[model samples]
Target: MRHLRSLLFVPGDRPERFAKAAASGADAIILDLEDSVVPARKADARKAVADWLASERDVPAIVRVNPLGSDQIDADIACLRRIAPDAIMLPKAEGAESIATLDSLLGDLDAPIIPIATETPAAIFELGSYRACADRLAGLSWGAEDLPAAIGAATSREEDGRYTAPYELVRSLTLFAAHAAAVPAIDTVFPAIRDESGLAAYVARAARDGFTAMLAIHPAQVAVINAGFTPGAGEIARAQAIIAAFADNPGAGALALDGKMIDRPHLIQAQHVLARAAASLLPSEGGAFSKAFNRSKPHTTSSR
Candidate 1:
């Protein structure tokens, strides 16, 4: 899970902002080329991404390209070879065949793929196939804007500040699809950059609904998003207690601990909390407390 609690989206056309974005406290950054860039600025965006990939990108950079069969696909590939990013974001992926084509094209290249299970109605039906991408497939995310428009919806949001019924179906399905395929389910960006409290609420809702991460359109949202997903110090302490108690009784599936009946499921949940803490310890752009969750050094040999 690599503590990708907050994935920030930076417009590919803004080359000057790229480095600043990389330096932001976000765990990973996506350089967006699809919706964010204007049609006339496509070339300029592509050139900027190519240059950044080649030299300037400092963090775990993901370059998102146009759809699979689009005119700019080849150009996207060329930039990939030049810049060599941690992953590539594929838009409008309908099923396994599209991923297979990307895998075949990459052939032996090591860059992973992050698919946006969004856009058209057909994509929603075949979303589960994205998990077959495996190691080269980093995560699964969705976009409400395109999908809602494709389905002829007035807006993705409802009066209660929630996704409309159709979009909600897609959102939940994408989460299930990601889980079924054994990958991280990343929630889409919240468009309201100025609403910090609203952003936190949305991210909290997403986390509760099984999303491991959420995309941030602005750096100001990063702290709130990260905070929303991460287990606080108090939670970490509780998880640690459960783990220690479980370790003390290896053969016991259930035990009474601190007045609660802690069982195997509790232990499993505790381990997940600890694992998340460990990943948060990576060289993230955030502060020291960010690494406080990462207890990786004491036992480096053990897999996270």
Candidate 2:
């Protein structure tokens, strides 16, 4: 799949909102069958998700199946076998073993996997193992909510909504792990849905810290996430200028660019910026998020 800037989550049991989520201008939609769905409704949710995936979709559809070792995962896999989604999001993923196990269960079904890499304490220690199964991964993401509860912490964040010391460490580890695996690093969700300013700042920080995409709990955050990840006009121009400077100095190890010294590393960074700029344009060119900002109807569903 193309580099997704925003992946919105919709409850699997709430089939009524599936269409809305598809039209929410998000790069992809995640049909959540894990913590979002109650245990009693697991079967019903599975059936509902299967029915939806049976049809065609413009936006990429990813199903967040129940974690490994759970009874629900077997049924979830059975449902996926009937109609596979574009990708699968594995929750509470421990390591390469988890990805390998899920791949074996998938058999002939060939959807890419995006694992929530940090949920349990054991998962933290296993981050380095993801490089082993990197080929099977779409991206690597982490969860703050589940990890805090799993470790018996009072909260993952402070009063300002910033992640505490322990949570920050895990977040940084997840970022490095994703890079080590040679895949895109996806940032976790910002749960405070109504705080638009906070969401924007968080998105900017995620982009600054090298996260290519972010998880969205609500449809409203899609626009902000998309804008934050996309390179600005000035950024694109600067990147182009840097590339041109390198081109002018063919064999030079270091060159002056607007009075500052730039080397091969700067050239590489400039190339990456241009690549991101190109990827950002894909969504608006007959992609799912083309008309995202045009819709005026506000979504009211609260994210869990």
Q: Among these predicted structures, which one has the highest TM-score?
A: 2
Model 1: residues >4 Å from true position, as ranges? Answer: 285-304
Residue-level lDDT tens digits of model 2 in 1-304: 2458999999999999999998988889999999999999999999899998788777888899999999898999999888767778999998887887887888877677899999999999989988777767778999999999997899999999999999999999999999998888999999999999999999999998989999999999999998998889998898999899878889888998889999989889889888998877765322232222121112211111
Local accuracy by lDDT, each model: 0.77, 0.85
Clashing pairs in 1: 277-293
**Candidate 2 residue-wise lDDT at 246:** 76
Each prediction's TM-score versus the true structure = 0.88, 0.92
How close to the true structure is residue 73 of candidate 1, measured as C-alpha lDDT?
A: 81
Task: Report the error of model 1 at residue 9, Å.
Answer: 1.1
